[model samples]
Target: MNPFLKPFACHWTMLDNVRVKKAGDIRLKATRSAVIYCTPCGRKLISQAQIDNYLHETKSKLTIELFVFDCKANMKQHYCPDGKILDADISNGQENVPISVVNEVDKEPNK
Candidate 1:
């Protein structure tokens, strides 16, 4: 599995946008966009014109990311020109997950 995609988990919400899940004192905010590479291809820079073209052609929201596997091998595939949007949810387990920076006040006192 891709290291970037490993932290993500499927989270369905009634809201029109993505959501973040948290456990205990930890909180994860759903960023509007996050840079990520395609599973089939590597990170490639895209132009504004290309992104606009894709959005117009697909008739999809600008918040969505594009995957271009149909392009030729020589062609570069850039998913997010504006920035990669996070569509998946972050896991909320208390196991061996790496801890992100958090305020000390947010943590509970030791038992």
Candidate 2:
């Protein structure tokens, strides 16, 4: 398993330890065998990652344009069936802003 890829198993998490294949497909092998529940349906669904690896290889560089244009929809679709949309904090081959701030107020002077 790649050190950079963290294996996560939760009601709101996706499968882990994904590796790239020579045929340009992403393979997801679950580390655990427990049944996971779906957030929307409340039904049990096996934690699996069934998306094709868009990139050619791990060593290949990922460009910003490719991320936004090519891979975004494929990834979203992969999770759509399982109803796992990548959260802001979840960094899964996409650009995510960890923190979101609507507005900031100025501090008052000390009394």
Candidate 3:
């Protein structure tokens, strides 16, 4: 009988709601994920916002850097800190472009 409380209740109970949201799928497009890789170590750190949040909360601001030895081999797969493999734009993550033009290069020839 309560109208205002209905939406919140729906959000709380339904596992289906979390399954897939827009675009007929739940996984986000690749552009949404961050490009994270560790250098001189095998740990790849994706999710820029999460990383920034960690740095912010911890108050330990040390500049973290990554060197792309081989973009393909390094970025073959990505995972969140929690160990969930991210599916954001994996298609374009592996590419070799001029140092200045990495993101702008055309990686989509399959279309």
Please, what are the lDDT tens digits per residue for candidate 1 over residues 1-111? 322222122221111122223222223345422222221122222333544464467564432333322222222233433333232223445536743332334344333
RMSD in angstroms, candidate 2? 17.2
Q: Per-residue alpha-carbon lDDT of model 2 for 1-111, expressed as tens digits?
A: 222112222222333344434343556655432322232224323323311122233232432222211212223333222222224344444555453222223333222
Of the two candidates 1 and 3, the one with more favorable TM-score, higher being better, is 3
Best by TM-score: 3
- TM-score of each predicted structure versus truth: 0.19, 0.15, 0.21
Q: In order, what lDDT does every prediction score?
A: 0.30, 0.30, 0.34
Compared with the true structure, the alpha-carbon lDDT of candidate 2 equals 0.30
Clash pairs for candidate 3 = 30-88, 30-89
Q: Worst ten-residue run, lDDT, model 3?
A: 11-20
lDDT of 3 by residue, 11-77 (tens): 3111111222333344534332323433222323344454455445656433222222222343324
lDDT of 3 at 25: 43
Top candidate by lDDT: 3
State the TM-score for model 3. Answer: 0.21
Q: Is candidate 2 or candidate 3 better by lDDT?
A: 3
